[model samples]
Target: MSSLSRRKFLLTAGATAVGTAILHGCTSGGNAPQTPASPSTNASPAAGGEAPEVTKAKLGFIALTDAAPLIVAKEKGLFAKYGMTEVEVLKQASWPVTRDNLELGSGGGGIDGAHILTPMPYLMSLGTITKTKKPLPMYILARLNTQGQGISVANVYKELKVALDSKPLKEAFAKAKAGGKELKVAMTFPGGTHDLWMRYWLAAGGIVPGKDVSVIPVPPPQMVANMKVGNMESFCVGEPWNAQLVNQKLGYSALITGQLWKNHPEKAFGMRKDWVDQNPKAAQALLKAVLEAQQWCDDPANKEEMVKIISDRQYLKVPPKDILGRLQGKVDFGDGRTIDDPDLAMKFWRDNASYPYKSHDLWFLTEDIRWGYLPASTDTKKIIDEVNREDLWKQAAQAIGVPVEQIPTSSSRGVETFFDGVKFDPENPKAYLDSLKIKTIKA
Candidate 1:
């Protein structure tokens, strides 16, 4: 497995230090106690049937509406049409819990796989989990959705007349720069995409994530409640959390991730490595079910119904309106801002958005190094190769009838540019990291 290069790692980690500090700092207050899950009631790993005769399987997800394809796959009987039977979908508690149960192979977690953030399966496979007994094999079968994340400010900030704009969406940053009162923003995790995206957006607009504004980590499900009480001035998170705020008429979207990076990868279908190795056919069949579901979801006619199914108590558990608000790319800022831009956020398609590229995986690893999660001098290329299960993703996509071009390639891709002019090249991360004007420190 390739590791992150020390030089590049230092650069990335330096840029992201503030975000990671916020993650570790904020969660230290202790979060809502997690509901313990009973051990697996299902048979052991050895109990799965031989061959792939039973087409149906159970999948687990937190009731976020973006699990739309999974919901649609079952609701439309697409899984059944593909020879899947008894396609049971279970809701999970949170990202960490979702990851743990999947790794442990227990509880409402009797899944062949699940809808996960792009970085999760990679982290689990790498044994990055602090207390996991043993690392399990993990692979992303296909990308599910992209660019549904947003930055939302609290009603108090709106009442206080804070400015949110195309540049520097954080109102607190400008206040601090001019020596005004400090404001706060919240995110889910330190090294995760939510934190990275939030930091990237703020930094691009000339706001320093750590110095210019105060950022905290609040679990995704708790974002709206936190903002309502003014625990935070603004937040950056994925749907339907942002949409939930709008539906409650409490907050509004200042920036959508798509505006940050069009057709970016956000979520994916991931399974344990051993599960994939042992049940390649089962994996392929399930991918077929989801790919078909993806096609259906992309259709405008099916979106309303798709929103309703995913919004059920078994899924996101939010109102269909909130679920559909962002899913359909129909924004409701609640402060009197609304628009319809379907392509602004994507569900599925043939673009690289659905394929997990090597560079994309490398980018996250770069972040891991930057935030001091790994040694600053690790081999970046080696780690990128190991984390990206491209071969497995390809096999699954082809089995589902997706075109080969839709699968990722190993070609070193150019770094993405924020509206502010920072560039990230998968091939030359060190130079990219060195170019940043942000504060840097040793990992």
Candidate 2:
């Protein structure tokens, strides 16, 4: 396939070292846990299908609200319904911590699965962004949610009257530098979703990233604190942190990511590749429960309960008010922009949101190569095959009773248009990269 050709080219181009330098740092997503309780052994994975090799598993997550499906599945006993009764949803301090914990591997001080950046599994398999040379192979079982993230600037940004207009941001950044202050913007991790969002936004505004302003990596939970302490002028992250920033009066929402790109893929339901290989039945069981939970999260009636569930001291630890507004499609920009936009809110299921499209993974791979995170000659298609678990997701979806018709006929979503009018064609990733006016590729 053409993917193989690209893979051969990447290896031929000597990009191994570039991938190594990135392993020491990176970022992704996840959420909370309830008090440990063995799931009731009611539903059985072995009833009519292949029996799972293992039933108990530990998964990791962050505080972001997009992690709702995982948290809900665990809290509501959905995992037990599929016989993954021992599943425990542990809260992670940051994305780096999540990666490190995953590297430890299941039962070895790490987790077996996670809710994470869609690109992360691909990067991990290629050894482009991990702490191990072993290259943990990860599977994208389903998407957790999409498009509830935002870029928030400190209160001073209110003067700019901005929404996708970064020129004002650039002018403010220049002014800050002229006053002897270096402007720093933070994202959850390097080479992850937030990083891409922040980079795209900054570049669109004519800011030369590292030159005009510094882009720093901060943990998800630490974003607000970092901003409060003047560590950064703005940050791109998932909610309810973004919403919390507005509630605390620390910053104003400059733009919602959904506005940046409608229905964009966000966090994913991911597990170790070996885990799937050794315990295929168990993996399907996990997907079955999580998929059900995704449907539950997408329900308008369940959103309020989901907000309250994740708002627990153990889950998101934020007030329900902070999370409830956005959960119901209420956007308070904190800059005098408020819109009841249910159309643009977060989605866990519906609209073919959970399918792990090979095209989207390719897009992220292209972005990795576009930036310095991966080598320009990186083999995207080969790594995409190694990381994306669409085949497995199909199996789980079928086993869970998702109609054959609901399964996408094609994995590619075709060429997508960005808010800036940039087009990303999965069939021609190189051209898409070349079309970009700003990039970090090295000759």
Best by lDDT: 2
Q: Which TM-score value belongs to model 2?
A: 0.89
Candidate 1 to native Cα RMSD, angstroms: 11.3
Clashing residue pairs in all predictions, respectively, total: 25, 5
RMSD to true structure for each model, in Å = 11.3, 9.4
Q: For residues 130-214, could you state the per-residue lDDT of candidate 1 as single tens digits?
A: 2453445577776787678888877655544332343534454575548855567787655667777777766666677677676
TM-score of each: 0.78, 0.89
The lDDT for every candidate, in the order shown, is: 0.62, 0.76
Looking at candidate 1, what is the lDDT of residue 404?
44
Per-residue error for 104 in candidate 2, Å, reads 0.7
Q: Provide the clash count, candidate 2.
A: 5
